[model samples]
Target: MRNRVSLSNRLKKVASYLPENANFADIGSDHAYLAAYVCQNDPNAKAIAGEVNVGPLNSAKDTINEYGLENQIEVRLGDGLEVIRPGEVNQIVIAGMGGSLITSILNKQKNISLEVDRMILQPNVDAKELREWLDDQNYMLIMEEIIEEQGHIYEILVAEKCNSHQSPYSDLEKEKQLYFGPYLLQDRNDAFMKKWGGERDKLTRVVEQMKQARQMDRDKIDQFINELDWMQEVLNNEKNNMETR
Candidate 1:
């Protein structure tokens, strides 16, 4: 039986970054959709779908069987990178999860850098933490893309292991870039600006709320103001660049 699965255009775009010849590991591979997509499209690619939950693991196995892709894809139930052996896969994709969890999985996996050549990550939140971890680990950020799907903006990071290292941006720039994305800062599309604009307004409200409170609250408010001011400045600079272009 040939069942059809639809991937979001954003996901398809991210998948395009995968290496031509790769043994791909799809961490949290719900339903095995991405593995199936890569196996079918990339002639030289094979995949393993790793899911921690039994239900998703079974679903992935069923999808693999239904597609007659048993030879090309394997589904295993385990947490994070624990499902794969070192050197078995060169490309890893971790999506549809929080940044903290993704970073934790990578951090906990021993010698993952020796096994994997590249990583494609899409975090639902806390992307700053993930970026920071990448910098610390000496993973070079190769590409970044932003997509708006179902009224939510998602950032996809494509990185590869690198020996040469540079310090991560200052805390202020890091916060702004993580929230708004460094690549998006260069392009400065309306969607990117709109996302940060909404956040800026939210921070403004918090600043106002902190202003009327006691000393302890005032200290918290000051911290928020400092962050907000930094982000605001970045946004304004991006806006000016967009106008000139």
Candidate 2:
């Protein structure tokens, strides 16, 4: 089932955000490919590949053995952070999962997660919700990135625990950053516009189809209109400002 000859561009972007010489853990790691790759590149890197399912756990073990990364990468079978204890790893990666699941994993593993120095999260969707959770937990987003893969845009959030609550967004932009990420908005890369542009177009079609049903869908129409408005504003403003800044 594994087709990975090497790390995908998306995962490579994720790995690039890691701290140097980090002690890392990759939660829901399907085949430990990222773990092996990281270990190979960073001499001081050591990783734990955490998988909950039996099949994936076996797959991770095989990957570890195949790369002769047994000394560098450890394969463990457990759900989320259950396989890891507090202070075991300084950096943690929760990729290829939904935002809500990532939130729950962090919530459930709160006691141990306190020891984690950094988090590299890639949410398939609902990235806003995950950021909210991180905000509540006092994690400060240090950097953000978006990558396009197979016609899909993925958002990667790099955060670290902080003593005080310092948000990346100012009060004026807080609401906007909640839906579109803070650094993502500031960066405004092609992937960002493409993702939101596609979303706006999809909502446009949905609104058009709903109009045939008449006023009954007024509430939904209003919501879509709001989203489209914000997106239009962003693309207009950000696209123009890309080069000047």
lDDT of 1 by residue, 1-245 (tens): 46665678767876888888678899998799888887777667899899999999899988888777888898988989999988888889999899999989988895764457799999877777878778778887777777788898887888888867754355666666655567767777766677778878998987777676665576677778887886688788986876999
Q: What shift in Å separates residue 198 of candidate 1 from its native position after superposition?
A: 1.7
Clashing pairs in 2: none
Candidate 1 residue-pair clash tally: 0
Estimate, for each residue in 114-206, the C-alpha lDDT of model 2 and write its tens digit: 668899999999999988888878899889999899988899999999987887878887877988999988778889989988888888888
Native-referenced Cα lDDT, model 2: 0.87
Mind sharing the TM-score for model 2? 0.90
Tell me how far the alpha carbon of residue 39 in candidate 2 is from the true structure, in angstroms, after superposition: 0.7
By lDDT, the best candidate is 2
